[model samples]
Target chain A: MTTIGENATIYREQHRVTYYECDQTGRATLATLINIAVLASEDQSDALGLTTAHVQSYGVGWVVTQYAIDVTRMPRQDETVTIAVRGSAYNPYFAFREFWIQDEQGEQLAYITSIWVLMSQEKRKIVKIIPALVTPYHSEAVKRIPRLPRPIHFEADTQTISKPYRVRFFDIDPNRHVNNAHYFDWLLDTLPAAFLLQHDLQHVDVRYENEVQYGHTVTAQVNQLPVAEDGTVTTSHVIQVGEEKCCEVTIRWQPTTQPQA
Target chain B: MTTIGENATIYREQHRVTYYECDQTGRATLATLINIAVLASEDQSDALGLTTAHVQSYGVGWVVTQYAIDVTRMPRQDETVTIAVRGSAYNPYFAFREFWIQDEQGEQLAYITSIWVLMSQEKRKIVKIIPALVTPYHSEAVKRIPRLPRPIHFEADTQTISKPYRVRFFDIDPNRHVNNAHYFDWLLDTLPAAFLLQHDLQHVDVRYENEVQYGHTVTAQVNQLPVAEDGTVTTSHVIQVGEEKCCEVTIRWQPTTQPQA
Candidate 1:
């Protein structure tokens, strides 16, 4: 972590977007964007000497529960972008962190606000945030957790499209669970390919309810809301393993001219 | 491309393996290793003014047909390794390239030899190597194609385990087809997780026979051979889209103590 001001601690890293990270439109996929943000936070934690192993030694691991992302534009292939992250505030149970991506010109491309909680590896339950575990980066301690906008629940009356996906071995991280970023792939992939090509994702609100395991076949259910007056489209998604819901996501997209394939 | 010695052109890049790229045992996945090698070759192509877009302008794009990989050990998470690649030789219809991974101490970890051919975008058929495109890499032109070891064909009598995978949107690259590296995931994931955890991959020979497109459900069929005298196990995999075969792979593994998950 680098000190920008007298009290502000920020961690920034430069990464060149590779072709494999992009989709058919030459823009980074939603999962790739989220992965880059998570990578930046992990780097920050490493710089603060609060590595994953160190935290695991305390019988807890950091797990993301929610993310609110606003994208002005997705990073393009071969573009060098900067990812900056900082721990903002924390209460007894939840920690709020912020991440932003910027192009080489310093223009911000996306901003993400995320909520994290300490989870007991053995118990598989949320644990209270230990003060010592998050004290190194100097985040403020607060009594009340911040209330961020939550993803909307799936509507019963809306028409839905569902797809089934079996979790692969590569989807499992070292923590023995599917990584959070992979949920985006399962969510957005249910949409029509033509719709994905003609639209640009503007905002996303995703909430994780339960962890998905390897070898499990999960169903992604998606429902598209009517286009807004301003020509933007909204969609709600639910990921489930059998009858148990694992994640919920709401996304807004702005239609663009058809991209040349 | 950098000149290591007179008449030798090489491209090398350093990458720190992130935790997301590793499996539960903290070692990089087969797809991740192959992706790193492909990234190095792409970087070399970019440096030599043979960018993908430039090649596509001629109505053709490079496609990998086969890969022969030998791994001493997979790189671990947070380990910075160097990936080096160079064009070795080319024929009228094929190009041969070599890639290797090295630790910080310069000890080699993995080596890959790949065969590439130009595929016409319109006809979707193999095209002869253009002299103008091959001249920049300075690889020797040979009349005879190199005879690399081929992946063994699956036997009809052998029992096979099959898993079906629907290609997702993110699986498709800028070329509008699933990237070749993704085949490794489908092939390796068919093995029992316990088997994967108890073995270390030593060598692999994969041959790509057809391209897989988005929205296709491909079945991965895997069969294991009897253990050899040296305690090595060999596995054969075939990826099929309905009646058409897309890929074939053979992998050799050495049994190790069960990894601590």
Candidate 2:
């Protein structure tokens, strides 16, 4: 197994900030930040010499089970931010990964940890994480595999919250799954663009535990108000399938960072 | 007119190199590059403070009547490239803009020139460039606006070639027109994926002169092929609408700058 030492492989995702990603409010939005984080994941996989085909070769692919991100500060439009990621652990079922966003000074501004399930691409059903496939990463900090607690007392709060959406075909990326950033597209579209554009989602603490199949129902049940901070509301949402928790997203929004003149 | 000096605008576009744009070949796919160029055009409009809402307020919106671009080099994966654009000319009938793409070292790689029409977005018909809207950029330079030749030599080649495609609703971006990148998607999809992945398309020279309404049939006609220094084919094609030249595309393939690794 690969370990993070002088010899362990660590992938660094380097990038600079651009204007288009910034809104009238200057800070990078949570959606945009998630998009960048996904890129870092791809880059990390590339560093492992894993191409798109390699991921698909197993007849399975990684689906973001969840993203829990904490942002201490958001970079401005012209500023640079780097996301570095490493495959932290893997069990029989899920591969655990940790990601960090740092400024030019190397100060970590945000951290995100996520669980990924191996799934059959064609059937879109969860598959066991092949021991051989994930066996290589155990050498690096093989500690307790942090179980992403299915939100305690987590209930969809409503069986009638059927958030109907037409899945855009192009939303399916080369990986043959909806690009994880697109999940925000599904969740955010329920809000007005004017409200979304003006506010910045500062912290995203989400747990994705289940897979939503193609041509199936995606019902987002907002359980409750998770937190209230800085004049914006934070809601806890879980996509459901009757008795099972498919996915959960907790988003916190605050005033957008003002744009630079 | 919001002139930088005496010109309404003397400007450069956002040079972006997002990794999400590159395909398995480690180069930005033709479709992604074209889409970014479209974003550059949108940025130009945004900088001019001419938003879609602002244009719609006048009962007209500028629709891409045509586009012709010649790509001399395809930027490598993760390389930032710039597109320089300027107003070529404008009249009561139509408006024209010219653009060029360059590397960080200022080496020109792509040249694009397009014609746009102020159209009523509601009724789907052509109209004149709004005078109040045109007043801002029309100057002495615009007075002697050059009649850069439109896509010519259409009547000589009547041999027909046709391909049918369904326009996905997502193909329409925020602008409500089919995203310009979708044109490249249509163009490239006609060829075998193996042909696209194995061999590099080094140069693309294309011109757009008309609009393809939703669900319109597009026929790609190859008119000529010129031999290249490296023993590759340079194909020139024109997409036509009966008697009208909608677009002309000149592609030079097997460019030498491809990464061998």
Candidate 3:
């Protein structure tokens, strides 16, 4: 079993934001931020001698089930940022991870918590977590990381806003599935452009239920929730391929400041 | 006026393919390859002290108008590839560049020829090429390079197949417009999956006409031509945003190997 100690490793990686990673506003996309975090986690796993090759050798792979992210500010293109990640803890079937993005000045920009599970490639099902799998990695459980609640179920019959998208070849990642991060783009794009332009994303909680493959046409539908007194608007999104639910996401947005003349 | 010289610099840069840059087939996407080429060109410009900031200081930016790419093979993820770029020649308003992608062993993977025009950001019009902008880059004009012919104008009423796509937030680049490369994905994805899977992209010729912005719903229409005796199929794509024609692309694909038993 992995023992908690001061010698546990916290992986750190620095990346310069590329033009392709930025959005129209020159800020790093949410998907890019998550990818940066994943890179840090992958580096940590590599350091522990648990690389993708090692996991595939055992006929299993790690899959993130849920993520909760909070952003104070989004990094801009050409900005160099650092990501620090650590395996917080693990239950029998679930492992928790925490990720932080900071600038060169050491100012925190974003914080994220994610839940992951092991899956058997042959069986296409969740596998029991073996003690050996998590023991080698540093385990320093975080006491107050934000918990991403289970995605709220949404009924399509009640949804008033629906957008259709076809999965392009570039959407597929090395894992042979539509990247989980792309779902954030699909969800946020479903909102009205006027609303999106006037607001900025504040927080997000998402859960992946099924994998989307290439050439699939997915429809994303959003159900608007009540607005808060603080001028925050919330929405629940359901992405579906035919009758299968691919994923669910909930997002919160706050009004953005108008540019001064 | 800039004079041709033997002392000009041919800019080169190396990049390792990331997971996000690969497609489901584990090969780097065509758009990703082109992005690598652009990075090399940008590096060359930056070295010449003609960075974006320098160009914008004059109220102009370089925009690629046409590209012709020939791929011998696509790079795989984790493969470090070098992109060497040089300014081959320039007319009064158009500058030509040549790009080559090779492995550490110096084996060539792809070669590209592109035509760029300086555009006034304020007036949104083609501007005269400045001698100072093209003089420092090497001008070893390629003796023979594939020329991208002007796209045959297409009548919307004649197009038989049309695919709808929204300009997602991530599609926007640092220029605040839908990236020129994303148009490649939108065009290629319009083909039937069966045809795409059975064939491999061998060459591409594209021309960018209009800039797409956030919230634009564009339609990509494809016109398939007769197959050649060598089993090569060609298609022409026209992307339109409402009544405004956005871009035109012509792609040729060759038959690929059958699936392994």
The lDDT values for all models are: 0.87, 0.61, 0.80
Q: What is the interface RMSD of candidate 3, in Å?
A: 1.6
Chain A TM-score, structure 1: 0.95
Model 1 per-residue lDDT tens digits across residues B165-216: 8899999876677877888888899999989989999999989998888989
Off by over 4 Å in 2: A1-9, A23-26, A58-60, A105-107, A120-143, A149-163, A192-199, A209-232, A240-246, A254-261, B1-19, B22-35, B38-95, B100-111, B115-140, B144-261
RMSD of each: 3.0, 9.2, 4.4
**Interface RMSD values, listed in order for every candidate:** 1.3, 6.3, 1.6
State the lDDT of candidate 2 residue by residue for B1-261, as single tens digits: 223214546457756565545554556667766666656766677677776678889888886656656666666655778877665567677777777778889898777666667888788688866766655543223443444444434333553334444443334444545565666655555444444555666556556667665445566565334466767765556665566666776665673444432
Task: Report how far off residue B13 is in candidate 1 (Å).
Answer: 1.6
RMSD of 2: 9.2
Native contact recovery (fnat) for each candidate is 0.74, 0.01, 0.77
Models ranked on lDDT: 1, 3, 2
Range of the 10 consecutive residues with the lowest summed lDDT in candidate 2 chain A: A1-10
Better of 1 and 3 by lDDT: 1
CA deviation > 4 Å runs, candidate 3: A1-8, A46-49, A139-147, A151-160, A223-233, A242-244, A257-261, B1-7, B136-147, B150-161, B223-233, B242-245, B256-261
Which runs of model 1 end up more than 4 angstroms from their true locations? A1-8, A156-158, B1-8, B156-158
User: Could you give candidate 3's per-residue lDDT for residues A52-143 as a string of tens digits?
Assistant: 88888889999999998888888888799999987877766777778889999999999888888899999989997766677777664434
Query: Per-prediction count of colliding residue pairs?
Result: 0, 14, 0
| lDDT score at residue B52, model 1, on the 0-100 scale | 84
Give the lowest summed-lDDT range of ten residues in model 1 chain B: B1-10
